[model samples]
Target: MANRGRLFWKILLGFWLIFLLTTQLLWAVFTLYNPRHEAPEDNIARRIGNVQIGTAGAVLARGGLQALEELKASWPPDERKFFSDSPVVDAPPQGEGALPSMQQTRGAVSRLVMAPDGQRYLLRYDLDGLRNEYHQGRRSSILHMPPPLFWLGLTGGLLFSLLLAWNLTRPMLQLRRAFERVSRGDLSVRLFPVMRRRHDEITDVAKDFDSMAERLQVLVSDREALLHDVSHELRSPLARLQLAIGLAHQNPKNVYASLDRIEHEAGRLDRMIGELLALSRAEHQGALGEDYFDLLGLVEAVVNDARYEAQVPGVDIQLTAHQPEDYTVKGNAEMMRRGVENIVRNALRFSAHGQSVFVSLSRVDSLLEITVADQGPGVEESKLSSIFDPFVRVNGPLNGKGYGLGLAITRKVVLAHGGQVEAFNGPGGGLAIRLRLPHWE
Candidate 1:
């Protein structure tokens, strides 16, 4: 039930969190890429220390301390800063041996070798300075190593997230407005063409919304027309009954005639009420069950009953089904019978004298196709699609035979059983109604 804006924020935040976690994971992986974490001995520093002292000691060995001083004076200014101490020359003290003991000055300079004579030489090297230079170099390399790539990734991720969030939220916002319009009785609202460029679940939802709106518009129109027709139908019979009652009151001697007329009108009213109830039930019926029965038998029964009741001059009702056995289908047998009976009776009512109403049944693939064709004048081409709507009666010679709920009820029943009904003008003449129902395999 959350709104699209809220959902968009939620999705964007989730994606951002994922991106942050991915960045952290990459940093961790890169930082720990060096498997050897144990600190190795400072071999480079030691090598620098050894070379400095060895070169100084070689100078002192080859020349005397004064010659070494001259050699140091001739060195570069950068190299002169290391020897910030005075040299010492001494022999082994009274009880000590001539062997040299390791000694360092300022934690950097150390004694490399003792002079061959009783005299000793000193060396100066700054180990701490060497370490500072090494660490600074490392820190500089780490901070400056291609930072642009990370910035580019961050910018790209932010833009992509914003774009994706907008794509998802914009459609939902449009759909929310569409729902609001539909709720306000705007059945003409549509989201198809607006979202047609998008190919996703949002587009699918838009398509469904368009279809639902279309169906709702049609149903609303049909219901309004049905209400108008029902009022007209009931008014006629009630007006006749009122007139009959008034006449009876005026002339008591002629009450029998008025009573007969009243009875006829009452019967017609009752039939109309019954048909309306039947139409309502057919429209709102639940799922059909597996009450498999002979469809052909049902059709035959309808045809026989219609033939006996046929009042049209010289009109005949005939069945044209020729099969080894009856066609069986799964559904409420009574409902199917009523549906077929309505089409046949409607056909019988319209046919002219000497005309035959043909009822044919056959299996077409997985369906039982039943068709009823009459020789009566077909309906208007423009009205053909709505002929099965409630209270929709074609303007023809036999229009007064019954209220227009028969074919409507027939359509409802057929649709309830997962079937369809269609009416079209027959090629030769008159109208043909076809009912296609799923047959039991």
Candidate 2:
């Protein structure tokens, strides 16, 4: 919560500071570009001062110095201070010099004017005094901005920044809370519904969070179910072992038979424990070290082993390859071999005498495809999906022959290697299992 508050304040202050800086920058630019700050002689006040001096010079040229003096005396005090003249000893030069022209001197302007009788007068006007009087009459500065407008803009910026910060932090706070709940084992929590209306990156993050929570929930549920199944499976073998010992104690004559039964149960327990370990290892992707090997070789090895087992049941195991290319795959070689062997052995187990179990390897696009099909009764359509689940066995003549962990282990291995496995009934009659693994370049 404190972090959220800090983030909110940071965003708010950042935007507000940017707004303030922008406004001040505009003010500075306006001050630098203002026309009043240009050359003094070209300013409006200087232009007005020149016009007054010209009027005085025009009067001196046409009506002589006495007439200009009379005109100045009749004017107001503020206007009279701007006009003054002195007589020149020599007559003004001809042409450009004879014309009335002004020169600037210490906050004032002086012009040489010629009377009709060749008498020259130097007329002067106070530019500083004119500019001062103009400013005093206006009673305002150009740089002075209205306080109400400044305060209104500042307040508007504050509100806008506050709104923007709140909108960003509100969703973050919600996601933080959702993460906290998930950490506390609350996987049922969902974020997409509440944030879906936003339709932004935040919504996409919420969607990913929801998916993570759902996957964790499924993993936890499956772990619990597997634990229960393991306990039940172990209990049966343990009970049988205890019963065999009790029988041996009661009947000494059949002690050898009881010992044989105990040995068989112990072997079965060992096999179950080994397969359980293999299944657990298969589920962990990290433990499956990356090692590239020929997938076709692995399939051939599994088929060769299954053929020996098939001889007793009078079942034929055939291996075929279609358009074989580089069937290299990257994963733990032992795990891959075990996964393929389980699928083939399962096919051979269900096949009757004089039946054939077909095993094929081929390359499809960027994937290596291996399929095992058996000429035996296939699994029910409803139970096809569950056949790869741990301890889930379809009811058949060989249902109790072995613990149902082979297909489950095979699925975990395939998934860990970024592959897929699926079981479906064959078109003719039997079960067909397919495995597809990414082909390494």
* Count of steric clashes across candidates, in order: 0, 0
Clash-forming residue pairs, model 2: none
Structural RMSD, model 1 = 5.6
Model 1 lDDT per residue over 1-441, tens place = 255478788777777667756765676576678565322335566666767666776766666577677877987876667654344656344222233443654348566344444355456677667666656544344333435445655676667677778888889889999999999999999999999999888889999999999999998997888778888889988999999999999999769999998999999899989998887777665645668999998988988888887854678887877587448888788888888888887888788788999899988888889999998888888999888877677774255556778889899899988898999999888999999988777
In candidate 1, where is summed lDDT lowest over 10 consecutive residues?
Answer: 91-100
lDDT accuracy of residue 389 in candidate 1: 78
Each model's lDDT comes to 0.77, 0.86
TM-score of 1: 0.75
Off by over 4 Å in 1: 1-5, 34-156, 245-259, 285-287, 310-315, 352-354, 377-383, 395-399
Q: Looking at model 2, which ten-residue stretch has the lowest summed lDDT?
A: 137-146
lDDT of 2 by residue, 59-105 (tens): 88888877887878878887887667888787537564266558976
Candidate 2 total steric clashes: 0
The C-alpha local distance difference test score for the whole of candidate 2 amounts to: 0.86
Off-target runs (Cα >4 Å) in candidate 2 are 1-4, 38-149, 248-256, 396-399
Q: For all the candidates, what are their Cα RMSDs to the real structure? A: 5.6, 6.4
**lDDT for position 183 in model 1:** 95
Q: Give the Å error, residue 416, model 2.
A: 1.3
